[model samples]
Target: MTKLSLKSKVDFIFIIIIGIFAILVYSTRNQSQLARDSRMIVHHTSSINTVLEKILSSTIDLETGSRGYTITGNENYLEVYNQGHKNLEIWLDSLRAMNELNRGQVLKLDTLERLIESKKQISALTIKTRKESGMDAAAAITKAGRGKEIMDSIRKSVAAYQNQSVKLLSANLNQSEVHVKSRNWNFTLFAICTFAILFFAYLQIRKNTERLILEKIIQTNLMTELTVQNQQLNDFANITIHDLRSPAGNITSLVATMEQDSTLEEYKVIFSMLRKVAQNLNESLNQLIEVLHLKKNKIIQQELLVFQDCYSRTIESLQGEILKSNALIKADFSQINSIMYSKIYLESIFQNLISNALKYRDPNRRPEITIHTEITKQTILLHVSDNGLGIDMSKNGSKLFGMKQIFHNHPEAKGIGLFIVKTQIENMKGRISVQS
Candidate 1:
């Protein structure tokens, strides 16, 4: 039956679209990871090359400074020699920190290090000989050609390390290119499939437009009937509450008089129980009357209310409770300061929300409440948030605004505040939602 329906066909197409979207997302993520790895390889290779070049430059500087000082016997040449040594040590340490090198690459690096150390020792020996021994001694050591051989060896080792790094980089880049080409082809195919499905779905949606128009007419008629029925239900509730009010009041009066006249302790206890029951019944009837009045009125008064004024009035009314709980209240009405709404309902909303925040605050921390206003294209939104014993949404979320539904085990929780707030907002064609 579902297969035969046009809407079902459209839904199936949409489901396919979602599947394709998921595949595309996965492909994109994989491509991103591969690209990231390639970048890391390139960066690592660049760092190694930079360190190698620095080591070669420092080796040359050490050789130059030693030779220059041996010939001229100048003290300034020692500064360059000392600086070259410091730079070489730093650059080598940096290269060694790069542990991603393979065994072959690490071996090449070790050979380079050995040659650099030999060159450094030779340069230091020449400098010390020139300083302590005569110029002849230092010149004799330089002329022996061992320092030249060590420098040549260092250069060759550097070239080998550089060649190995370039080879590895080229291999990695080639592999990445292959993967990229495959992924690009697959993505192109998926894109073509997505376009074809969307085009087909668009045609199917055009065909369903007339059916939607007819359904809208039927829905309008059904809404009319629902409105009439709702009015009738409201009337019935009004009559029921009116009939029950007198009986509830009578029960309360009788219980009170009986309790006062009772002599026996057991009878007094029984009368007290009856009194409590009667009082609860009376309170329930009163709350019901208030709700029925809202339904009957249909159109309550609306006025332009300034948010700051309303907020201040509510705060003033609850000044005692706020001080007692050490609540820090904040308000921001900068977006839209005024709105056309019922004054009583707006004030009641502020009062109930703030009272709950202060009442159910976390005892370990001082209470902090934030009230703010936001404006969308067509609606003004009021938000109230607090640091308190939050509702257990998993257990009590559905029944949060239901009549007489209490979540926290507080003595003063009548459970009617949220119910009344929700009713008021909905009565004015507004809405309310909560997050824990």
Candidate 2:
């Protein structure tokens, strides 16, 4: 398991907790708003009820006062009548103001207002007749069917207003309950979603940790394989160089001994062939030895190497062959001064490239080689180019620097020169590429 730092773990947990708290706060606020709406609805309903009750009581008081006046002709009945009329007027005004605040109550309040007006008109007519005519006449007017009909109509209107108020209150209550329930469920779902997201983030962190470990293990295994391969290559080169050195030494000694005598023509020819073979073998062995040395170490045995000096030295090594092939060699090292490099490796790379150019020259054209160097901020680039027989792109382009790979079917081609060149450059923490 990969252990997270305390701060990071705390931050992750803090974010999850904060997220859940935010959701809960939002849900609580919504529920609070719904509760406020429900309370307001209840208050409005109570207010409407109070107004209706006042109106009903005022109508009842007017009927009683009119009856009292018809029977006794007392001034107290008129006073009671006036008080009830004032109360009714106040209640109707209050109801109208409430209806303005609550649009849904407007129609019911209008109907109630009309009923109160009709009741007021009938009570006024009764009062007027009672004051002018005698008690019997006023009593007769009070018992008339018109006044009773108006009272009945007022009762019917109040009943309708009361029924409508009850229905509206029930609807508001039901809607408020539904809103509360939905808020509760939404809070629960939000918490569940936050937990799932946190869990998924945890799983992803664990997976990434495991992936990093696996990649590290893979890189270690690759490094081990490369080490083993390098060791095997070095051992092979060492053995080959050791075996060839003995015969090369013997042939050089034999050639000196034969030159001491006036040799016969056949003997001279044999000695010359042996000397040429020995020289080629020595050159091949030296190349193998240089490759082996480079594989065993990283930093080269650096020595001051002047570009012009190294160029001349390489030219001298290939002088006889260059002359035989009539090859043209050009050099431009103006941008470079004396630099440090391993002498043997540098000589080998230069010798192989120049000699290859000569060996692979086109039969119909003269061999031309150009050697130059360019210096950049981070590295130096050395380019060795030739206008000889260009490489065959279709056949051997990809395997140009592969071990024991040859592009041309030349008798002297050993196929290891470019491979050694690439290895040496890599060992020195540089890179090499060829384009032909």
Please provide TM-scores, in order, for all candidate models, with all chains considered together.
Answer: 0.45, 0.43
Q: Write the residue-wise lDDT of candidate 2 on 1-436 in tens digits.
A: 9988856875886698787778777887877798779758755765675577567657766765665566567778777678779989898888888778667678767877777787788888878887887766766776566776777678678768867876776677666656655665655565456556556655655533454345456645655665565455443443343333333333334333432133345343443444344444445545544544554463357788887876765665454466567888988999885677876667666767787788788889888899999999958889999987778666777888877787777876777777767766775678998776
State the lDDT of candidate 1 residue by residue for 1-436, as single tens digits.
3345786887898799788879877987887698669757855775576567667667766765776687668878787788888988988888877843477776777887888888888888998899899788998898898987897788778778877876766666665665555565556566567657756765866643554345446645655655564444433333333333332333333333432224445343433343343333333334444544554575577889999987875665554466467789999999999999877668667867887898789999999999999999879999999999999889999999886688888986767678767877986899999999
Candidate 1 residue-wise lDDT at 5: 79
lDDT of model 1, residue 345: 69
In candidate 2 the C-alpha lDDT for residue 395 amounts to 76
The parts of candidate 1 lying over 4 Å away from their true place are 1-3, 195-436
Provide backbone clash counts, one per model: 0, 0
Query: What does candidate 2 score on TM?
Result: 0.43
Each prediction's RMSD to truth: 33.8, 52.2
Residue 414 local lDDT, model 2: 71
The CA-based lDDT of model 2 is what? Answer: 0.66
Q: Of the candidates shown, which would achieve the greatest TM-score relative to the real structure?
A: 1
